[model samples]
Target: MYKQFLIIIIILVTTHKSVKGQDNQHPKWNTWATWGDQNNGTYRNPVLPADYSDLDCIRVGDDYYAISSTFQYSPGIIILHSKDLVNWTIKSHAVADITQISPEMNWDRMNRYGNGIWAGAIRYHKGKFWIYFGTPDEGYFMTTAKNIEGPWEPLHKIMGEAGWDDCSPFWDDDGQGYFVGTNFKDGYKIHLFKLAADGKDIIKGTDKVIYQSKGSEANKLYKINGTYYHFFSEVKADGRTVMMERSKNIWGPYTEFKQLSHAQNDMNSPNQGGIVQTQRGDWYFLTHHGDGDWFGRIMSLIPVNWVDGWPILGKVGEDGVGTMVWEGKKPVSGTKIITPQTSDSFLGTRLNEQWEWNYQPRADKWSLRERKGWLRLYAFGSLERNDNLTKVGNILTQRSMSTKANEVIVKLDLSGMADGQKAGFTHFGHPAYSAIGVHCDGKIKRLEYNLKGQVTEGDQINQNVVWLRSVWGFDGVSQYSYSTDGKNFKDFGPAYKLMWESYRGDRLGIYSYNNKQEKGYVDVDFFNYTFAGPQKTKK
Candidate 1:
C-alpha cells in the first residue's frame, strides 16, 4: 500500500510540473506558424519564416537575444528574445527613428528605399547591452543600454564616412575594443579598426585591410580559445555560402578561408549571420537564407561543429563543407513557447512591437489616445510628390512570414472619415503596392481595391464599419477581400503578386491617405492574422 501511494504521488507531481510549464510557454504559434518546434525535442527549418534578414544573435546567461536588419523602416533594428533558440518573440527595437541618419531617409523624400539600417550585431558587455550597425549611404552607428529591455542611448555615429556596411564589434581579453565591417566602395573589402572605450567612436588611423575578395562581406569577429575567428559570407560558384577564417593575431596572418556551407538546389544560399553559444557550451548559427523572394530572406538556425579549431555550419559533408539541415534537436528545452507578436486588438494605448512605420512618421498624424480603444489615423497627402500609395507616410506594417498560407483581416471604422480620405488594409515593398480601402468624397464612400494604379471599386459602402482582408501563401499570390458584416468575405481586386523590393520582403501595411486634401481620418479597431502550419491556410 505504501509503494502504491508513492507511485501515485510521483505521477501527480510530474503532471503538475508539466501543466505549470506549459502555462508559461503557452501559445507558441503551433496554430499560426508554418515551421518551428515539433514539441518532441526537435524543431524544423526556417525557424523564423519571415523577412528578418541579416540577423545577429548573442546569448546572455540562459537567455538568447537577436537583432535583425530593418532597411527603410523606422524604429530600425528589430530585437528578438528566446529562452531556447527555436522559440522566439519580438522583444523591442534599437532605434526610434533612423531618418535622423540623413534627410534622404525622411518619408517625404522616399529616397532611402534600398538604404537604411543594414546588417548589425548585438552584444552584452561589461553589464550593458550594445548594438552596432551601419548604412551604405550613412556610416556606422551604435547604441547601448544597461538592460536588454532598454532605455538605450540615442544613436552615436561611429564612422561618419559612407559606403560601409555589415559591421559588428568585438572586445579583446585585455578589454580593448575593435570593429569590423565591409567597405563596399572599396571592392567590398573587410576593414578592421580600433573602437573607443565607450564604443561610440572609431579611433582614427587604426584602420587596416583585414581581408578582401570578389564578394566578401557580412563581417563578424570573434575570439575563441586564444584564436581569433573571422566569420563572413562570400560569393562562390554555388552562390553565397557561409565562410570563415582564423588567426592567432587580431590583425592576422589568417588561414585560407574554408567554406562553411554549400548552396542548396532551390535557393541562392544560406549565408550572413551571427554565431551564438548556448548555456550547455554548444554553439549554433542564426542565419538568413541569402536568397530574396516575396517573403525576403527568412531565417534558419544552423548547428555549429568545432572540428580542428574551425567551426563548420550546418551538416558536414565529405568535401569538408556543410549542408543545410531541415530539422534538428533544439539547443535548449523545457522552455515554454513564445511566438513573435502579430495580430493586435487596438485595446491598449501603445502599439505592439511588431508594428513599424515606412519611415519616420509624422508624430501628430497617428493616435491611439484620440479614441479610447482604436488606432486613429489622419489622412494626409502622399509624402512623395506623386500619388503612389507606397509613398503614403506612416503606413504601419509588420514582417510577412514565409509560410504556405496566411490571412490578415482588419476591422476599420470609417465613421470619422472626411472628404477625400481613403484608408484600409494595404501592402507595399520596393516593387509594387496595393490597397483595399474605403474612399470618402463628397458624402459618398466606395469600397475599392487599387493595385499599381489599377482600380477595382466595389458597391457603395453605406455601413460605417467594414472588414478588409488579404490572403496569400507560399506561391506569393495575394487576393484582397472585404465584408460589411465581418463574415462571408467577398474577394475583390485582381490577383496580386507579393514582391521583394528595396532589400525588403512584402510587409502587411495599414495606410491612410488623401490625394485631394489632408482633411479626414480612419479608426482601426482590431487586426487579426492567422498563418497555417503544413496544413493549408484558406480565407
Candidate 2:
C-alpha cells in the first residue's frame, strides 16, 4: 500500500513540473503576447524559430515538416518536425558540411550574406523526398533522399535561370507532377512545366505560362472542391498583399485575383505559408512575418476556411494579416516545453544545433575537451571588421530574444591572452562590435570596445590579467566592466548604445575575437544568461 502511494506522488510531481515547463517554452502564440494588436488577434513576434526565415512548411497526416532559406549560412538545409504546426523542433539538417557544396565557399562570397538559397521547395513523393532550390545570381538545382535525414544525393542542376527565387512542385490528383516558379525580373510570371516520370528531369516540351503576378515570389497551389487556387503575393493598392486566383483546371485560366491580406509596414510580408488540415478536418494557414532582424523573420498562423469552393484566408472583418493561430481543435499531443537548445557548457562533443558560426568557421578556430570543461577560441583575423566579412574565430551565437531586457554573463579564464593578443565578449550587430582582454605594449590593458561602426569604450584600466563581464541590454544599450580579483569589479565607463552601421537586426551575443598576427586562444569556462523584465534589477 505504501509503495502504491509513493508511486502516485512521484507521478503527480513529475506531471506538475512538466506542465509548468510547457507554459514557458510554448507560450500562447494566439494571445497578444505572441502576435501584436495590429490585427484583431494576438501579435507577438518570433514565433516558430525566428532564426529560420523565408520558411516553407507542409503538413502530412499528423506530422508537420518545414525548411527555411539558409542564405550564406552553411548547414544549408535545416529540417524541422512538429505534430502541431505551432510547435516545431529541429530534427536534423539536410546539409551539414558547407564543403559538400563547394570547397572555395566559407560563408564568404558563395554563402555571401543576403545571398544563396532565397526560398526552396521540399516535397515528398513516390516514397522519396526532394528539395529544389536556386541561387538568385546562379541557377536552380534539385536533390533527393529516400529518408529526409538524408544521405541527400549530390545536388543536380535543374536550370540556370537568373531571375527566380522560390520554386515549388505540385503532384496533381490526376497522377502527374508539375513544377511552378516565380520569374520576378522578366515578367513576374508563374511558369509551369511537367516533370518526367522518373522525377529527375523536367520535360523539355511541357513549358507554359500559367499565371502572372504583379509582384510575387513564393508561390504554391491547392485544389479545393474542384477549384484550383493559386495563392501568391501581389503589390496591391495598399502595398504587397497576399492574393489568390482560382480556376476549374490545373492549368489556370485562373480567375481574377482578389486580395486576401495586405502588408502593413512589412509586419505582414506573409511571404510563404502552407495550408494544413488538422485531423479534426479544420484548415489553418502557417506563415511568416518580419521583425527587421537578421533572424527576426518569424512564423505566424491564421485560421483558413474554404468558402464557396475557394479558400478564404481568415475572416473578412478581421484585419487581413498573418494572425497568430495558437490553439487548435486539440492540445499538442506531446510535451509542450518546445524550445531550441541553448546554454552550452562547452563539455559536449559538438556545439548544440541552436548555435551557429558567424561565418564559415575554419578547422583551426577552436578546440574542445570534456576533461577541461571549456571551449578554447583561438585568435584569428585582423580587426578590419565587417559583420558579414570578418572571419573571427569561435563565434557560437543565437538570435536576440524579444524580451524587454536580457543579460548574458560569460565566465572565462583569459590568463592565456599574451601581449598583442585580445579576447573577450562581443555583441554582433553590424560592423561586429566587441570588448576584449588587452595585453598591449608590455602592459595589461583593456581597450575601448569598437568595431566596424559600433563604439563602446571602457576605462583604460591598466591591469594585465583580469576577468571580464560585458552586458548588452534591450534597446541597443550596452556596458562593460572587469574584476581583478574575479569578484570585486569597477564599472569601465559611460554606458554606450550599440549601433550596427550595416547590420540587419538587434542580434547580440558573446564572441571571442583576436586582432593579432600570432595565434592565441581564450578558454571560456561557461556562459550564464538570464532574461529580466523591465522591473527587474540589474547590478
Candidate 3:
C-alpha cells in the first residue's frame, strides 16, 4: 500500500515543520485580543534582560561577570557577560562619563534622584579587571582594567565617608589582597583593607576590625579549599528579612551568626549577595529581589552547600529564589532575542536597550532615528509629575516587559500640539507617577489618571485630532480609554487601582512622558506590547 501512503506524507511534513518554527519564534504572539486575551503566551523571567538591581557576581575561567545597582540610572557600571549561567549580554557601560560620577548636592536628603552609583564589586585580579564601588554620598571608589572594556580609569576615591556603602574586594592565594567594607558605621565593623599592586590604593594595612553587625549590610569574603569565609546580611523586623553570616579567619575572631534568608512575602528584600565557584567545584549565590515598585529589580540564584564547613542555603527550595543554571549551551555567546523589545514599527536603529533616561541621556530629547521608523518625542518642561520633572528634566523610562499578564498598545498621530503642548503615556516610580496625555491646553485636552503622590483624573477626551490609548495593570490595576477614529475606544472611567509605592515581586511596563516646555513634539505612530498566560487562548 505504498507503505501506507509514505507514512501519511511523513506525518504531514513533520507537523508542518513544527508549526513553522513557532511562527518564526513568536512574531508579536497574539492568540486573541480585546482584553483577557491568551493563546500562545510566554515570558516569566526566562532571564531576558531582567531589570538588574544591586547584584554583583563573579566566576573566572569558564567566564561569568556581572554588575548592578545604578541608582541614578545613566549608563553607570553595567557590564554583564555569561557562559551557561542562563544567557546574559550587555557588553559595556562601566561609567560612560557624566563626569565619571561624583557631583551631587542633595543626596544627603538620603537620596535625591542622583543617588550616584550603589553596590557593585567584580574582581579578576592578576590578569587585571576590578571594580569596587561606593558613592553613597561620594567617596570610596576603584576602577581597573586589562580589559572589561575600556581605558577605564577616572574614579579612585577609595574612602571619603558618608557611609561608604557596599564595597567588596579581595585577592588571596597567599600573596594577599583584601577589602570588604560595606556601610561602615558603628566603629567600622567589617573593614579589612590591604591592596596595592597597581590594582589601586589602600595598601599599608591598619584597618582591620572584622565582623560587627547589629543587623547587617552587604559583605563578602571567601577562600574555600582551606577554610576561610565570612558573608553578611540582615535587615529584618518585618522590613523583609535577610539575615546571614559566616566566618573562619583572615582577621576575624569570628563565629557563626546565622538566619540565612527570610521574606516569603512582605515583598521580598533579598539584598546584596555574591559568590562564585564552578569549574566543577560548584557553589553559587548571586542575588537581588524586589521586582516591583513600578517594576525594577529581579535576579536570583542560590545553591550554597558546604555542610560541615558551614553554608547550606535554599538548596533550591522554599522559593529561596533560584534561576540561572546554564552549563548547557553556555549562556553568553553572541546572545540575541532582543527581549519583548516593545514592538515599535516606527522602525529601528536605536533606543532599544530597553530605553531608559532619568539622569543623563539627552539627544535633543528623543527620536529613534528621525523619520525612518518614526518615534520622535520632543517636549520638556511641564511634565512635572515630579521627581524633578521640571528641574532635573522630564523622564522617559523602561524595564517591565512582562511577568505574565500583559498589554501595552501605543499608537499616536497627534496632528501636532501647539500651545504648552503635552503628549502621553507614563508610569514611573518612587512616590508613584502615572500618565496618559494628549493636550494643547488651549483647545484640546486629556489627562487620563494615576500620577502617584498627586495628580488625579483618570480619564478625559476632546479632539482636535484623535487616536490615543493607555492601559497599565498588575496589583493596583488600571485601564483608560480613548479614540476618535482608531477603532472604537471610549471608556475612561472606574477601572483604576493604583496605590503606587510598589516593589514586591514585580513586573510591569510601557511609558511615554511629554510636557512641552519649549519645542514640543510627539509622533510615535506605533508601539504595541503583549504577554499573557494561563494555558494561552487569545492571540
- Judging by lDDT against the true structure, name the best candidate: 1
Candidate 2, clashing residue pairs?
34-44, 35-42, 35-43, 35-44, 36-43, 36-44, 444-464
lDDT of 3: 0.56
- Return the TM-score for each candidate structure: 0.92, 0.77, 0.34
Selected candidate, larger TM-score, 1 vs 2: 1
Query: What's the lDDT of the predicted structure labeled candidate 1?
Result: 0.83
Q: Runs in model 3 with CA error above 4 Å?
A: 1-49, 53-68, 73-115, 118-137, 141-158, 161-166, 169-178, 181-219, 222-226, 229-284, 287-398, 402-405, 409-418, 426-441, 445-539
Which should have the higher lDDT, number 1 or number 3? 1
Which stretches of model 1 miss by more than 4 angstroms? 1-34, 384-386, 534-539
TM-score, cand. 1 vs. native: 0.92
- For model 1, state the Cα shift of residue 483 in Å: 0.6
Residue-level lDDT of model 3, residues 1-539, one tens digit each, is 99999999999999999986554331121111211111122222224324577788888788787887666655566777766344455666666543455543221121335357777788888887888788667767887777886667677776667766777877878667788775555643667788766657776555776666555567777777766676666555555444444455676666655555555443255557686865777676667655444445556555566555655554333444322221122223343333324455756766554444555644566777876777777665533434232233435555543344555666665655556566666545554455555655565566545444344553445654455555554443656666777788875545544432323112232333444446556677676666543223445
Candidate lDDT scores, in order, read 0.83, 0.60, 0.56
* Candidate ranking (TM-score, best to worst): 1, 2, 3
